[model samples]
Target: MDAQLKHGLLEVCVLTALYKEDSYGYRIIKDTSPFIKISESTLYPILRRLESGNYLSVYSVEHNGRLRKYYKITDLGKKKIEEFLDGWDEVMNIHNYIVTETRRNENE
Candidate 1:
């Protein structure tokens, strides 16, 4: 996948992950890795950006005797999700049309 595409999609994936419930940094990394190739370094900056944007909020909780920061989506995050969904729909539609047209032309 293109780096740009990965960067663009990461935020959407992160927000969606948090939509169900709050999660800590490591857990988020673990969950997202299977779906998207993300680095721990890359994810921290994105998390910071989201928190600064008020799309997500974080608080620390002790788990396994370690202080872990848990993130949850805010109302702004929900709005962002809606926006991402609309954008994804458009991207998919365009991709499908192009692929279909290409196949049709090839068959001619």
Candidate 2:
């Protein structure tokens, strides 16, 4: 995947991960791993950006002998997800156009 595209989608993926439940950094990466290629370094910045934007909230909990930071989606985050979903139609339309055009060229 293109680096720019991957970066763009990472934010949404992280938000989606937190949509259902609050999760620590490693857990979020694990959840998103099945779909997107993300690592701790990449994910921490995304989490920070979301929290800075008020799209997510963070809290710390004691687990084992250390503190684990967990992220939860905020109302703003939900709205951001909705906005992405709404824009998906346009992206799909562009993808379909590209596919159709490519097939046409292949046939010709």
Candidate 3:
């Protein structure tokens, strides 16, 4: 996968995951891992960035006597998701066009 593509999609993916429900850091990592291999260290920084940017809010919750920080998308985050969706559609369309053309040429 392209590094630029991964970087572009990471924020959208995180926000989309939270769109499903509020989740702790670990759960976010687990859920996204199947689709994208994300290191905990890398994910933590992105979470921090999103929180700092006001795209997400975090709160502490006690589970099994351990305090975990859960992240929830803010209204601003929802707006960002909308913007990303638009960008995602454009990127996918371009990618599909390029791939389809390549396949057609290969069949010639």
Q: What is the lDDT of candidate 3?
A: 0.89
Span of ten consecutive residues with least summed lDDT in model 2: 39-48
Root-mean-square deviation per candidate: 1.8, 1.0, 2.1
Candidate 2 root-mean-square deviation in Å = 1.0
Give the lDDT of residue 83 in candidate 1: 94
Candidate 1 lands at a TM-score of 0.86
Better of 2 and 3 by TM-score: 2
lDDT of 3 at 53: 96
lDDT: the better of candidates 1 and 3: 1
Q: What digit string (tens of lDDT, one per residue) describes model 2 on residues 19-83?
A: 99998899898898999989889987898899999999999999999998889899999999999
Cα error of candidate 3 at position 41, Å: 0.8
Off by over 4 Å in 2: none
How far residue 85's Cα lies from its native spot in candidate 3, in Å, is 1.2
Task: Return the lDDT, model 3, position 88.
Answer: 76
TM-score of each: 0.86, 0.94, 0.84
Candidate 2 to truth, TM: 0.94
Q: Which candidate has the highest lDDT of all?
A: 2
Per-residue CA lDDT of candidate 1, range 1-108, in tens?
Answer: 999988988988898889999998778888888899778899989999999999999999987998889999999999999998878788999999999999999999
Per residue, candidate 3 scores C-alpha lDDT tens digits across 1-108 of 999889867887888889978998888889998998778888888898999999999999999998989999999999999998778788899999999999999999
